[model samples]
Target: MCNEGCLIADLELTFTVKGSHEGSQKILLDSDPSLRIIVFHCVINEQTRLDVTLPEELADGNETVKSGVLSFPLNSLPVQKEIIVEEEAGVVNKYNNRKIIANLSGDLDVRLGFNLCMEEQEFLRKRKKYVAAALKKILHLEEDLKEHEVPVVAITTTGGGTRSLTAMYGSLLGLQKLNLLDCISYIGGLSGTTWTMANLYEDANWSQKYLEDAIKEARKQVTKSKICCFSLDCLKYYYEDLKERTKEGHNTSFIDLWGLVIESMLHDKKDEHRLSDQRQTVDNGQNPLPIYVAINLKSGYSAQAFREWLEFTPYEVGLLKYGASIRAEHFGSEFFMGRLVKRLSETRICYMQGMWSSIFSIDVMYVWNLAADSEDFWCRWTRDRVTDIAEEPFLSMNPYEVDTCLFTPSSVLSSALRDVLTGRPTIAQYPNFIRGFQMHSKYLESEGFSTWKDTVIDSFPNKLMETADDELSLVDTGFFINTSYPPLLRSKREVDVILHLNYSGGSQTLPLDQIAKYISGQGIPFPKIEISEEDRENLKECYVFEDADSPQAPTVLFFPLVNDTFKKYKAPGVERTPEEMAEGKVDVSTILSPFTTREVCFSEENFDKLVKLTDYNVLNNEKLIIRALRLAVARRKQRKY
Candidate 1:
């Protein structure tokens, strides 16, 4: 794809070599490979433009008190001075044996920049119509609501394999029944719940249609025989899929393999669905715009110290923190210094799903344990309470940090494949768009990057910009926080309400102590979470948390996946008979529970039980939900006045 004045070199970091001596610090080039040296450098014209050795503050560290900040409505990017070191040897083939003439084509650069893409801006303008109509209908307002006056309502669902997938459908079903589905302006999720959003968006008019049929189809997929997924034929299909993706110059990892497995389990055939294709679902403001989330973390960076959240929409894939984005179709394409170097085929939605929900990157057993622990992690927090020693191991061994592994390959193929991918990092790779950008000198005091004093390395400017590497390691947002709140929290979004569904293995959905701390730390406006000790231990099905003192903070309605009244009343006021009462007794807390995150093949009965529970819970809480919506509108009007 390169014409002239183009340089392509493979960058391999060798940690073991330090002047032919063994060490843990990473030093590029040579053999030792024992020491991990952290350095950042930029090169132009086969010469080093800038190189800085990163500090050791984040090398061995835990979570810190870095205040993450983001500026909204960035209409202009920081003007950067490009430095080009020149050499006349570029046109001459000194490295190649054959003399070749270079093609100097017109400099028609295509780089998605810091300003919000035009596509999203147009989407917001169109989406307002739907929001206005839905708000007027649901709020029972006689007068038609003005488009600008409409409150931005978002629904955020967390991830948990099939459990979340089934529950998401049920929640949406209930919303549709209540005529509240259209009221939502945006819907987003991470991990398994993304599956629900993907499948729904495949149908352009899903939000307008009755969701019962979709639910039934999802139920079938969830209940099918997963054994065949690992069978030889499916394995061959996976091999070919990976082979093709690799041939296309895509980085293949265990995550890709898991995506193929997920494809077979959730889909009947290979699909051409891409994130960009979903624009049709929201083209006429007929459906909520979907925001799928993934996070970026460097290989050696402290998982706790740094997290770069990437939000994907039909229009663009962006990092709200940096105010930088690329067109959705250009997401996986190679880029350098704010220019698209090479264009790869847009990634299929299945692979996107894999990147969004990459829990299988490591071993399954450990993931299950993490799920079992994560359920209550939110509730077990106090402002004074630190993540106890018991939780350290889980925190330290992030899935991306662990070696990628495979399961259930028949005969020797599985073994051979496992060996080939055994040591690769557990993350999907994409060319970093932020590459070649220089960090602001006084960024330590900048409003965008708050000067943090709490963390060791996070306090350093160079370390904060260290993620400006060649490739971005995008993995499931579950690595940072399971909730899909980050993207919605962007100041530009101006969201007024958040309906958070905890479909993962969690007893408490609102886990305010944890979620509150995280949001407050980032300087985002969120409701105060003050659950009493009594409430923390025993979570309620629905919670409405808000900062009465601060109207800017969005009102959050948290719904945890707990078996509550759905047991006594199967379908919102429909009482279960003596014989059918057993159906209400859903095992939501056990590792072997029907709603376990680890189980892909849920029995039909369990699927119904789980799906119905979410459906029934939403229906039962309809009055409360509507009340919240009304309050949100009232607040929006108050602000308008």
Candidate 2:
């Protein structure tokens, strides 16, 4: 959407390319692609535009520093510049028919300026190598490693690096160099988790594409007079089309009906006029649209406190820029149970399908559980609470992001379909193919599962909680959280499995002999159970203390038996270092520090089994249990009858 005589702003953008190439360090282009490059030259409130280039520096054959900084002049004047690099065409193929269009828009003309250097020639020669290695690492880690499978890869802080737009440029360049661009797909998930539509990052065209797709669908539905259809015939066709279009459609899909509503409103000219009029009514600035946050009460953040924490966060302002409003929901003390019941009850009212319904409901429950389960979390550390409780409606808080858990329109659609088709109540549920955790560990140990599978093992120490009158003592014997007493006991009986749960910090108090005896009790175990002198030394390093400096290692607590009486270790009166706050250079709020245990507590076998047997009973509804049992019986009969 461009206008005539618009002042195109000439801005120097710098970012690093995170990929590699085989030879020479020149900026590479794709073989066959539509180049939609829009370089603008504009004057924002009398700001002067200057053209400049920075020299890049190389270190040990690697490009380490980018040169040239753009300094805008203080004077305000009508500036005229020449179109310098328009005719610089690349090696073209007749079959490709790629055209680079030079269009003058608004008050600015745009052109490219390239500065090549020979210093990084050697590095450039092996650029593709580095890129390929990095990508290979990423892929290998994703597919093989069960512990560190990356669910999301966020590209940020681009312009400041030696290779500007390094990650994005590198990914695209890598694809071209390897001739894999056509083979792989770039999937975009659009989120409307915010209160309003206008407040969003426009850097990625994916969001726009999601919107465009929605518009196309809404237009088709409107044209066919199928918008009013309640038979779900349109929905059925839409899902089938989605499955064919997406690779992950077999197990995942998402839909944003709220987005459709917005499209329909825009389709109506009257609503469009009202929207324009509302925009003009902003005297100071645009008011923030409302946002809804649902959390479990166990996160230790009261509804009021969480609001304050949000106010203190950087995204608080950023979210406002995108027409967002915030509200918090504390789902009482029973996180999983409350969520399971709520979603099951409210599914019909929200007009949601499988993924959308599951994600929206489950995230509220899961995130809340995570928060409640974290330590020393102060929810009200920042500002005054603007709104209280679960005040905002779910429809208003349409799109949102909690940490890395993104719920977008596309993802919602996929998830909904997967949920319905798979007969799964929650996306987090695992199958009971594993007997307790034994079968699960075997599955993980297989070469086919990937590296993350190794994360399923539980080697950490468990902490046992005691009553107030009980003396505080650490025993080598694993114990339970006082609150988890009934559930743990119930689970032990139902599954015939002993539970090991606690915080590792308290493991130090347990004597070595006691630990050895406990391990000896684990029948058919290896000699590693016999703690030697060297083992004691190693165990000391692994034990809990405030001075623990295992880089990126999350403090873990476990319980073998469920109990309610657990000791809460308060963070000593010391400020956390900057390094402590950033989870691999990502700044998460201190309030969420405890739940940041990145490591899975149980072995994969244990977790999967626990999820299958315990999570369903603990995390789902009784009806789900009945349905699951019936399904199992039916499958058995199918094999027998």
* Candidate RMSDs in order: 15.6, 31.3
Alpha-carbon error at 441 in model 2, in Å?
Answer: 37
Tens-place lDDT per residue, model 2, 139-160, is: 3333322211111111111010
- Identify the candidate with maximal TM-score: 1
> Can you tell me which runs of candidate 1 are displaced by over 4 Å?
1-115, 364-416, 442-459, 464-468, 510-512
Q: Give me the displacement of residue 620 in model 1, in angstroms.
A: 0.9
Q: Residue 281's C-alpha lDDT in candidate 2? A: 20
Candidate 2, run of 10 with poorest lDDT? 156-165
Candidate 1 has its poorest 10 consecutive residues by lDDT at 68-77
Q: Write the per-residue lDDT of candidate 1 for residues 1-641, one digit (tens) a residue.
A: 11221121122222221211112233332434332223222222322122212222322145432221111111121122212222233222221221112232344233333445666677778888877887787778999876657788899888888888998898898889888888888998889988899999999999999999999999888888766565557767877778888899888777777677678878888877999999898878888889999888776765566677789999888876565678889988876545566679988998888889986555542432343355342222211233433345544455445443323323455554554355545788887876655456664455434411223464555765554366888888777667788778776678888998888785554434556788787677788776677866776778888777888888888888887787788777789899999989998877767677777778899888887788888888887888887887777777855
